[model samples]
Target: MQKLKWGMIGGGEGSQIGPAHRLGALADGHFELAAGALDHRPDAGREYAERLGVAPDRAYGDWTEMLEGEKGRSDRIDLVTIATPNSTHFEITKAFLEAGFNVLCEKPMTMTVEEGEEIVRVAEKTGKICAVNYCYSAYPMVRQARAMVQNGEIGKVRLVVTAFSHGHHGDATDADNPRVRWRYNPEMAGVSGQFADCGIHALHMASFICNDEVATLSADFASTIPSRELEDDAMVNFRMQGGTVGRLWTSSVAIGRQHGFDIQVFGETGGLRWASEQPNQLIYTPVGGRTQIIEKGEGGLHDDAQRLSRVSIAHPEGFPLAVANIYCDLADAIRGEIRDGLPNAADGVRSMSAVHTAVASAKDGGAWKDARPSIFK
Candidate 1:
């Protein structure tokens, strides 16, 4: 199979997400990083590009320069991954999509619902792929959960309870940290902070695994750190299609907790529990039966789960593999191969809608609000 030529924007030196994107793109070998604007500073970007072993001629100082340079090339990038700040997502994605390049963007796809919808419109008009990186959905057990929920193994999901917590932001001093300034700045991270950054992932995961959509929500949000401009914690009560009720608690200031992405879905006949910390195995309890640990590559798993598992049950697959699976799925989609469950632009809008509406609900004293209307049809 021919590898697709790939380019990247952002993910400069010391950026946590940049290496993850690089490792993910390299993991499947279906795409190659041909070019990049690794940082805003032209010199740093070029240096970083060279460090990544990219040809010096292909690296550009900024996104516009890279796009302009690539547009004139015979060996143009087939796709570009945007790992920049939340505020930049709209313009970068639009530019690439307008240039007829497929886009894979990190989430909180856009800062506003209108911007996210505009992306959907542009992707539809361009006929190019636009995927959002909700990487948790790519986990083997997550795939299993989705399949089982859809196949009635869970017998009609009636409720979902999800919590994602991290103590990394617990330090009040971080409010003034130059590194995380964008996270606390509303203009950069948008109207919401912790909820927009981490809560949406939990929201998306619940809907994804349950094959449901969050219809409406009531929310409470707080910025625990003094002088912080955005929220660090959020509690949302939501209802999904077919009467599935759920709650989501997301916090960046949960002292002593780190990477606590956990979910529980209960149906009439059984329930399933999965956590990011224990990604390779799912805890399943059938009504009136003993609890079971369903590991990856084990029997009783669906084809979707088996297909995503890259190693044996005990080997353990986590974040990098999850991202690789997303890249692999994107590669399949780009090749026009049959694939399912890669979060596309519409899904991105769904999550962004939740983010927006949750902020609105919180601001309005926890009043109920409807999520963004589904634009697909």
Candidate 2:
């Protein structure tokens, strides 16, 4: 089997997303961490390299330099994993794609729809593998939900509901971690704070499971905290293109919650509910029967879900392992193997549009409009 050598663009010391990327990449063994440009800070980058045991010569202060210098090395890197702030995704990703390196990037594709379109253009123009880290798509139970819905096991999807809230310490005075830094900075995070940060994931989860996109939406949003520049909380209502009504409440200041990304898809015959906190199993309830707790890596699941569920049932698989599925699948794609299910730039564009629509609607007093169309198809 062809192997993929990996490099990281961010996840330096004290950064939240980077280490998560590193862990996911390492978890699957299909890829190797051969090089990295962990942070914009040189000292921090070096320290991260040491901590990761990456070679000093392959580490650099900038991702561009690493990409340019490594281009000719046959054994260096086949794929680049980006964990940078929202503002840098477009430019950095374009460079890497044009350089013929596959990419697995963080969500909220780019800061704007135009940039998102351009990223899709380049990825298609290059014919190289490009994927976004929508981790829920990797969940075996999530796959089961998607399969059941698409295969008519749930009949027509009636409504989809998702709730993602995180009462983060970012806005708290007593607790200040670097993880909350980019989140509070509008320059780095762009417009609509925590919604884009984590809401993007929830949006993707809902759509991925139902196999649809938002047609129209209305939203209510607030910063909550007086001094903060970004929205700490929001409420969004929408209808997917196929007439499936939906509602979402994404917040960073919802007290008593921690990284909550949960969804429920209701259809004519039955429904399924899944939560990020509990990735190991999915709740399936029939119209007249009791709710069946469907566990991953078990019998009676779709072939794709079974293959991705590498760990045995009861051993448990959550956030990190979900990401590992993406890592392994993308690596397989990069190496010229075809995987059954993997989220690509097309998923990114729809998610980007959903997020932009939610933000715009909230800003306009919960006004409704058609969500932006995907540029991929």
TM-scores of the candidates are 0.97, 0.93
**C-alpha positional error of residue 369 in candidate 2 after TM-score superposition, expressed in Å:** 1.0
lDDT of 1 by residue, 209-234 (tens): 99888889999999898788899899
Give the per-residue Cα lDDT of candidate 1 at 312.
Answer: 79
**Top candidate (lDDT):** 1
Q: What is the lDDT of residue 199 in candidate 2?
A: 75
- Alpha-carbon lDDT of model 2: 0.81
Tell me the lDDT of model 2 at 125: 95
lDDT of 2 by residue, 1-377 (tens): 54568888887888867767778888867777888898888777867876787888888778878888789886868888888877888888889999888888888768888788888889999998779888878888888889898898889999898998977643577334656655756787787787787777777777888888777888887877666677777788888878898988888887788868889999999999988888888899999999899888778898768878878887788677788888878877877786756888877877777778877887788999777655633
